[model samples]
Target: MGTPTPPPSAAKIRRTSSSGGSGSIILEKYQLGRLLGRGSFAKVYLARLLDNPSAPEVAIKVIDKAATVDAAMEPRIVREVSAMRRLHHHSNILTLHEVMATKTKIYLVMELAPGGELFAKLARSRRFSESTARRYFHQLISALRFCHQNGVFHRDIKPQNLLLDQNGLLKITDFGLSALSEQKIDGLVRTACGTPAYTAPEVISRKGYDAEKADAWSCGVLLYVFLVGSLPFDDGNLSNMYRAMHRRAFEFPDFVSKSAKIVIYRLLDPNPNTRLSLDELIKLSWFKKSFSQENLRSQGSDENPTGSEFLDSKQFKFMPRVNAFDLISMSSGLDLSGLFEEETTSSKEIRFTSKMEVAEIEEKVSKAGLEFQYRVERRKGGAMRLVKGRAVVVVEIWGVAPELWLVELRLVDGAAELGESQWGELRLGIGAIMAQ
Candidate 1:
């Protein structure tokens, strides 16, 4: 088979430029610009690939490994890459281009979300019309359906994590707090994660809870916020917040349309068992009218049983639209991935499949100034670690089927946060840095 064709989105890019920080030379491939955003462990920068200006500007997340106060966060940092790689193909999910690393830092190159955070959008608009709100909610539901189908649970779902592209499309970002269904103990996620305001009652209770239900509850909170311009369950005290959520104590403003109220009530249903499913929500008169086939895709209606060439035709108005929702809410909702599901799927675990020689790989690392420490053989492939002033760089290579090879770069300490000079040199030595 020939090389796979990339999505049209891969070709869309924002503006790009470069600036000197501390009078140092910038990386050649990426012309680094201004700082975009920052958190405790990472800082995002606006960067453009020199070879492809037509391609969208990438968001480079520079992760400072040595800055981590807790050793436990290390695993979670690595897990973010695995989670994004699997979830990248969806229209509503963030896209990760590559993850490169040094001994002390890890670099994440991702899609630029020029429209900014959905929260900022909400703040600016104050509130949305019922018609406008329905459009955004339809997109959110589509994203969630995809995650649940793939067995990934975004435990955190709030406006803050939801981003909007220039087209006003929803893009789900942060995965640091998410958990895969397979990782649960006894089909129950025991940890309490997510912002308190958006968290479900069961999740904040500290008792083991269903991941699907917890996320649904959060989604409901977002809907309410989108329509009301404020959170449904806000309070100064933590105890008060939990009390309100447990009892479903919030009230709707007079302006909220009757149809919207119906969906909100069911979405915030205190009982997870009775909460509305994706099918039921789309079937509502409000959704059907505003969220027709033209406006959005249904997670539960992929087969298009009617075989109608015009799925979005208004002619179906009097033809009983119930089947459309029923189809979407099937055992598994409609899939937007279509027959191209293989294009979206990627392995989360690290494995090597490069044709490059091992000796050449070692020579590159040595030439980059990382002092070779030692190498040890494992059952399948050996491992090696290099050091330079308390910084640690780990190299893991393994053999796979049909005589394929792969190499992985892991940043340990001091070296993880590379100076502009070191990062540039290391990139040249790393042979075919592959994304798993």
Candidate 2:
């Protein structure tokens, strides 16, 4: 048999430009660009394949191995990479192009969502109409169903992690907390991890729980947020919040349609055994209405029971895609989470822009090391570091545009002794050289 045509996504990956390059290039395949977002241990950047003008833009997630190891997050990171690689075929799931790593850093090249996070959109619009909410809900459920059938469970489900493409299609991301079937002990998952408001009560109870059922609970909470613009269960006190979740207590606004309410109610059922199964969910009257059959592909023989097309004549109404904005105060009801707190800049951090080539920046660091009696070393992933008797400084170069780069120098260790003078001299030295 002619090798069954590789999936469309697999074919695209095979056609990506081969890797080879130094300075601003990741493994010679992708050239890194402006920072898209940052977390405690990782930074996501916009990037594109080198030597291929028609290559689509992608996001490269650069994870600091040292930082993650220190925080005991190495296992979680590994699980995320494994799960995404196995589950990228679904329409609503984010696509991970490839993963590359060095001794100190791991890079995950993935499809970029130009439309940004769903959380940001909801923040701007307040809440969606019933029909609009149903559209997104249908897509999200379809993806969740696929994940369940494949034995991967996304423990965290929220608007912040649900992204949108240019056409407003929902894409699920951030699988760091996901659980695979092989990881289970005695056919059950015992880990208690997920966002407080979105976690299932069974998980919070510390008793082993069904991975798929916990994920189903989160899906319910997500749908509630999409329609109400707020969390279903939240409180200033952690105990109180968990208590509310145990009872599955939440009220729908007058605007929520009866059918939508029924769906949410079934999904939020505290008893995992009675929770709406994926097979049952799609058949629900609410989920079937106006759902675009073309958007959902049958996964197996049992997926479409009748093997007949959905007869709904109404076209799926497309919601307008909007720019993302910082989420403001969510004091609508029992809001207590500091989740949406605005980010603040620190006084010690310094940033500068330059037109110098990446190689020139490396040369400057070498000269600085000689002038200051420090050892200049090259990190496996194209980063540079200066070490003087354990006082270490890390330098990274990010390409923002052609001929323009943003270089960041951070003091990693022995800050008290090297405080201003050591790094200051190095910064001034590098800046002075760039000024030439």
TM values, all candidates: 0.64, 0.63
- The clash count of every prediction, one per candidate, is 20, 2
lDDT tens digits, residue span 1-436, model 2: 0011111221233222323222267644567888889999888888876766466678888877678867887778767865764454455788665555544566777778889998999999999888888878777776776566445799999889999877787889999999976566655899889998898888977678988888888888888888989998989898898788768778999989899899889989988999986567778888888766555533332222211212321111111111111112222221112211222122223357667677876687578667878887763323366778756665645443346555555454455566566666766776676666
Task: Name the weakest run of 10 consecutive residues (lDDT summed) in model 2.
Answer: 313-322
- Please provide, for model 1 over 69-99, each residue's C-alpha lDDT reduced to its tens digit, 9 standing for 90 to 100: 3544655664466566445345567766655
Q: Give the TM-score of candidate 1.
A: 0.64
- Give the winner by lDDT: 2
Q: Clashes in candidate 1: how many?
A: 20
Off by over 4 Å in 1: 1-28, 69-71, 297-436
lDDT of 1: 0.58
